[model samples]
Target: MQQQEIKALLSDMSLEEKIGELFQLPSYFFNGDMVTGPAGELGITPDDLRVSGSCLSVVGAERIHEIQQKHIEKHPHHIPMLFMADIINGYRTIFPIPLAQGCTFDPGLAEKCASIAAREAAAAGLHVTFSPMADLVRDARWGRVMESTGEDTYLNGLMAAAMVRGYQGENNDFSKKGALAACLKHFAGYGAPDGGRDYNTVELSERTLAEDYLPAYKKAIDAGCALVMTSFNTLNRIPSTANRRLLREVLRGEMQFDGVVISDWCAVSELIPHGIAADEKEAAVLALNAGVDIDMASPVYLKNLKELAEQKRIDEKQIDESVLRILTLKNKLGLFENPYKDGSEADEKELLLCASHREAARDCAEKSFVLLKNEDSFLPLKKGKESVAFIGPFTDNQLLYGSWSFFGDEQDCVTVKAGVTQNYPDADVFFAQGCPTADPGTNVLGFQKTPPKEEFDLQEALDTAVELAKKADKVVLTLGEHRDYSGEGASRADITLPSCQLELFHKICEVNPNVCVVLFNGRPLDIREINQKAKAILEAWLPGTEGGNALAGILYGDASPSGRLSMSFPYCVGQVPVHYNHMSTGRPFAGDYRTTRYNSKYLDIPNEPLYPFGYGLTYTAFEYSDISLDSDILHKGDSICASVRVTNTGERPGTETVQMYLHDVSASVTRPVRELKGFCKVFLEPGESRVIAFPITEDMLRFYNITMDYVSEPGQFEVFIGSDSTTSRKAVFSLC
Candidate 1:
């Protein structure tokens, strides 16, 4: 329905009916104590007060039907509640965590995961999934990093669009049998919280917000996401839920996002804490004017929206617009058509945990493993070579299934020990717990860092692992942050491997240098110390349900590790804001630091990252040569073509990702040293070579101008073609 028509209908309604449209009753109706529904003192009985609609929780088909029947009976409009849930990763067939999914560098996989998650959610009677968190997370110190795609704006935008398409489909209708409404959450600058802390203040320049933060949300909006959730943090000095410039000018006006804008949980109430609104009435007025369509889990809007409308404090048209959006989303879900549609109940809870879903999870688990280093082919441990010792707290534990895993069952998840036993039935496989993941922060200065209490002993586990490593022919040392280290509200001050585990690996390598280190981490880590001693380093980034099988497959050469680091692997945390796309400093550094030259360089470590974004190694080798550009100068809208010859020089067939980076040597505003423009992935057999070609145009070269319009600047551009971020062949070009 059009806003004008909804306004006409709402204008004819009484004050109580207008109030009813603004209120979203709690689903706590199922939790008993359902006297009134609104706040404590100003409550009204269910029979007395008229509720326009409600928000519900999904339990089962029969239960949903019961609630729908009861809810419709109370409302004269017969409006049904919108059922919502935090189905982030999956509803039934859980895949890898979002971070791991991002590592695959394949939007198809993310889309597929979203499709499955949507399917299961719709089947279970869920109308909306609060997901596809398009927040561009730069700091791995944020606990919600696991939920975000990664640090890059373009990559996050692509994945966000893909996931929104997967969830809501090309059409925004959720009435379809396999569709659920997509909610692009934490709407503006939620990722850049102070000190990478969740729900903290976000102080950033307007250009930074437009250039870095807002693009992903725009992508989600373009993909036709049904709803957008306001972030908890304040942007600049104003709360995002109440920021008119962010929600109105930017999101609705500039981006033309017509979908519903919902407040984050209790975020409307937080406007008081943000000191923007004096009370609930002012908060309601601020949020409504800011274009927040629905107030979630906050009673401020329910309490004051109608009174504001009646008193002309808020435009009656705005109230109707917000209500219409809420009702429209419900209508889109076919809730208004038939709120109790799924009446059929079956014995399918067992079928929810199917083998096909598990297999898909396994495929993703394997594909997401990144091989950081494989010196001298120490990997692909032959079927029956020598004794292999698997050591660490997570080597055989099923709890390593990362965070935000809704459907990954501990019983169903495959452990490394189980996988190894299954792969090499007759081979000698030794197991050790190693040290506790959380350890005492004992230092040489005799200062002790208190450790979180765990159920296991630290020294015994380490001693047992060391003893086993001494006897084994080869040792597979698995180490990383505990599963709880990177999920929601689990940010760490120091993003390094646990001190004890690092020490353990160093000691174990001293005893035996044949250590194959498998890192199971939620986010990037500083593992430079272990990288030096470990013969092979496999980054198994919190692989989900079939993780063990995937690990065994990669270790035994059943599959090649093709995943690249979506985020940079920092050598240390001091490089907190480090990225390849950093703006060029006034004086850029060159050559080694020992020359005593004053330039933009770090004193101790090289400016280079430990492992650049898109950097990954395989057991096999691929060579890049023969770079050519069609034209050095081209007119606007003219295409410039380039190609490079890639050859597989190893015995085994593998996939190689050719990355194309562009550098605008000079621009109005300082540009990044390098920016990823395009990429292509291809598979090759042993001794096979193929010519990879890419066509670049003005669109690929566009940047936000002083007027905030996206346009390409006339400049000398350097094009690079290579295997990863660091190594490439350069060719110069100019646009005329």
Candidate 2:
């Protein structure tokens, strides 16, 4: 239905129905915290779902069916409440966390994972998923890095589009199985938190917002996402939840997004803390007038909206528009036609975690593993090795799937211990919990809040790990952030392995020179020490459910790790803002010693990251040679073909990501030192070679032009081909 038609329908709504459309409490409201109004006249009984036109939680099939049925019986308009849940990663079938999925560099898999998640979630009565967080995360210290698609704009955009397609599918049909509406969340620059702190202030120039932050949301919007969730952070000193320029001017006007704009949980109320609004009433007025259509978990809209409309502070038109959009969303969801339509279908299922879902979970986990470094053909560990020591806290812990993981049983998840045992029942495998996840200084003072200690004592655990390593032929050390390190409200000042763990890693390496390090992390981290000590490094980003089987498969040559780094790994946290594509400084790096020291280079560390973006190693070796270009110059509407020969030199089959990058020698505005234009992943057998090529046109070179118009400028461009951004062969092209 057109929003205008829905507005006419809302004109006939009673005060009760209009107020109902304004408030949407959290699922905790029904399951736990029951709020009563001061007068006790207005509220909902826990057992009475019928009177509640909108609600938040829907756990299992049974509760969903019961709550859904109850709502159908009571609502006067019989409009069903939208069943919403934070099914961020997966519903019942968990996949690798978003960062790992991004590492796969496969949009098809990203979409497939979301589709499976939607299928399981929709089966359990979920109408919406606050997912595919389209925030462009540049800071790795932010705990939410795990939730984002990584630091690159183009990569994040691709992942966002894929996720939306996966979640929403090709149609708006919710009756069939596919995805529930994919909520493009934390809209705008929430990822640019001050000092990488979660929910901190984000002070960005308009150009930075447009170039770096806004593109992902724009891409998500273009992907046909039905809803958008505002951020909790303040943008330009205004809380995003109440920013008119962002919600009204940019999102609705410039982007032409007509979907429901929902505020982050209690974010409307947070304007008080932001010091932008006087109270909840003022916050509601600011947000509602700014084009926020839904008040998520904050009752301020219900409390003051009617009064505000009556006083003419907010026109009835604004309220009606908001309500109609929401009602339209409900109608599109088929809730109006069948509030309890398939709510009962959840109970009809015999198994929630079936074989197919688990298989998909395993496949996702397998693909998300990225091989970072492997010297002396150390990887694909020879089957039936005499003995191996599995050392780390994560070796047995199943909670390493990161945060917001649903429907994945910790006990059922494949731990490194279990996987190794299952994969090689005959081989002797020693195990040890190297150290506690928590820092010692912090843990001692926070005993009251901390969980009970598990495994061995911290020092003893490290000692045991070192001792066990001495007895084994090789050491397979699992390292990196624990489950609690990243996710909601978890940010870090230093993006490095905890000192104690680093010490343990060094000790294990000392004990057994033949060591393979498998990182179980959420986001990219500084790993200079690990790079020096370990002969091999693998980034296994919180693989969900079947993470163990996947890790074991990579270890035993059953599967090859092809995933690449989506986020850059800094040598140290201070080297942040270091990406593959960066604008060259007026004083570029000089080759001379004196000039290099004073130029745009850090005194303590190199400007380059430990591992550049698009950098990843594979078990088998691939050689790059024979670069060819169709033309040395490009004209208007011309496409340049850049081709290269990629040959697998090792005695095994493997996949290689053939990347193409471009550099602008000089332009009206400085361009990135190198920009990723195109990439193709191909599999090759030993001694087999293929010519991989990419065509680049004006569209590929277009940027926000000199006049602030997004267009391509005629200029000299350099094309590069190699494994990553930094190490590549270059050829110059002139655009005329």
Per-model TM-score versus the true fold:
0.93, 0.94
- After TM-score superposition, what is the CA distance of residue 613 in candidate 1 from its true location, in Å? 0.8
Off by over 4 Å in 2: 1-9, 32-53, 341-351, 441-452, 590-595
Could you tell me the lDDT of residue 399 within candidate 1? 65
lDDT of 2 by residue, 321-363 (tens): 7778788887777766666544445333633567887788888
lDDT at residue 427 of model 2 (Cα atoms): 67
Tell me the RMSD of model 1 versus the true structure: 3.8
Q: How does model 2 fare in lDDT?
A: 0.79
Each candidate: what lDDT? 0.78, 0.79
Model 2 residue pairs with clashes: none
What is the clash count for each candidate, in the order shown? 0, 0
Q: Which candidate is the best by lDDT?
A: 2
Worst 10 residues of 2 by lDDT: 443-452
